[model samples]
Target: MCEEATVSLADVVQEDEQLQEEASAVLAGSDSERCSYPQGYVKRQALYACNTCTPKGGQAAGVCLACSYKCHEGHQLFELYTKRNFRCDCGNGKFADAPCKLFHAKDDVNGLNKYSHNFFGEYCTCRRPYPDPEDQEDDEMIQCVLCEDWLHGRHLGCDVPDHVESWEMICEACMNTHAFLWRYAARLAGKRRENVLRDLTDPPASDPVPGAAVESDAAKETTADETDGATEPSRKRVCPEEAEAKPGCGLEALQNAGAERPGSGAVFWPPGWRSRLCRCDACQASLAAAGLSFLPDESDTVLAYEKKGRSEEGGAPGHDPLMSALDNLSRVQQLEIIHGYNDMKSELKDFLQGFVAEGKVVTSADIRQFFERQQSRKRRRADDRFHCA
Candidate 1:
């Protein structure tokens, strides 16, 4: 459905009572899938699962959403899902209304929290945990779109565009490889842009070599400026031929990192970028030795799914829900202990096998009255025995 179907406030209130009554029956054994809620214990709604109660060898059991905080709050949860076709088990023998075990969300039961890089409790190039509220306050971390690694604001240097609103961000390695195309993409147009992204890549004229020598005139002016406390006007530029042929430099080999040489005619940027992040042999060797890449994947952060995917909306507003909170007594035991079970079950089975039976409404209060009457009879019998003696 598109929008949330608006529900009437009065109708919801009416349903609330029926919902509880129906839910109680389901927990008591009307629903075959659930054992019934233990007698005398009424429960709230069902919308969350408790991974802590998962049997060592059996299926996981669930309680109501409120029970998460009310009962199993500190216990590791199964990332909360809608309790479809199931009943709440709170206050039942299985759940027994245990107090929630958690003091904080971050202190999840083992494997309870989503796992990924964050499982190690550290992220990004800075190797810090996502800023915890318990620790001192800190800056927000930005995730790189291409590599999917998180980084603090200061570590990424000053290359990210200040006005980036639509386009995704890449790591330094990817930006270096695709900088040429990103800069002059409109100028390159169709085939030329592809070619540039693929092969015959140009060296960045803008980047300065770490240790290139300066011309004598420029060096002389620099010394004079230092002595006079004046600044030099401009620096000399290296011609294209000299840069391309810089002894150990390999402008031609960069084509392999970026594109097919001639007949093969395959593109390389995206694929190359991924292999490099995975530390494939060619990418590792090329990047490690030469500080460059072919190109990188637009979305390299596949690990996000394992961590964030579980936390998506667990349930939505709906007219119907599930509840089944029952005890696990043997049939003979239930027969001996619960005089009303047989009667309740027979009536429960007739309504399309659902929980709500006709006429009688059984809530926790009814069970309380039944026990009170039994105790009252016991006291009267003791008075009669004393008089006879």
Candidate 2:
């Protein structure tokens, strides 16, 4: 016989709590009340694309969170997640019919904002939307830290590594565009992607993997045995002993390096890899030339922006007080309490709806008066019961 799925009260409550947390994380860096246009190119903020205004094959555009709610309400929107150095493009020559309700003034165009395929409600290498109807496999998509574009695991050109939370992924497109990163991959990123790059490069049959550096403080020389994936008949590679003195030598070694191999695949760089990048004068110039000056700045990261948002909102609730209090009661008592709570919540919502229908603003004094009326009704019921007894 088939069995019915059962869920305990604690399990239900925990699932609801988890859902709330996920929502909070997704909205951590978004401001829903005020327009972000005045900010002028925010380092990082949650963004949305309006298909109703700029549909597929049209000029791509994105708007800030507040614009999504106040201006693009009832319109189809694609959540672009957190984008770096983005400015709101709502009603800025892009939306001729939709004037922003929150902010009046706007430039004809936000020249700095970059738009990708995601702006038109498309994603992944396949260019399909999330929860795609054509796709049957239940694969998860991951956002590239550099491009901010989401890609399915199958399209990443490498196996998704375990414990992905501990590292940040840079897609192959970004990796090849800023090829210097490949020089650091062997030392800082996971072996999976690095191995792919090595296979594509096909370094001098049995020669040590190019750009693979030995991490040490005292060792002056490194043999092929010390390098990752290096085989026997090992060749000795000389490098600076002091870690501080190594960046120049390392970068110089790869100065004459040929064109970076395409399809090297996406690489998962471990934590602290950003700080480990060579910040020497030559490297800095190279970064600037490639328009990746923000790469070294921690403040430019999405995590940092989300943290700022959480701090401004006084942080997410650590625990629900009502849930904690309910834990002390029996299951029957818990159910009764929850039922009462639900009735009150529903009634209160309906009460508020009356004011909303009349376009009336709810105030603190109004809430106090509401509770006072409830108390008076309870007293009248008690008096009627006393008289009957």
Number of the top-ranking candidate, with TM-score as the measure: 2
Off by over 4 Å in 2: 1-6, 191-250, 253-263, 314-389
Give lDDT for model 2. Answer: 0.70
C-alpha lDDT of residue 336 in model 1: 52
lDDT (10s digit) by residue, model 1, range 1-389: 69855544344547997776444432322222332232212221224455566433333445544555556657666432221223454443444334333222211222221222432344566666555455465654555543444565556653333322212335454455544323222222123122322222232543222112212232232223223344334434554455435443222333334532222111112211221122235434655454333223222222212112222212323322211222566777656545555544454345322223233444567557656865787689779999999
In the order shown, the candidates' Cα RMSDs to the true structure are 23.6, 12.7
| Model 2 agreement with the true structure over 331-373: per-residue lDDT tens digits | 9999988886787788788877777566565667888988898
TM-score of the candidate numbered 1?
0.24
Error of 1 at 121 (Å): 0.6
Q: Which regions of candidate 1 are displaced past 4 Å?
A: 1-117, 134-138, 145-147, 159-166, 172-389
Top candidate (lDDT): 2
Q: lDDT, candidate 1, residue 301? A: 23
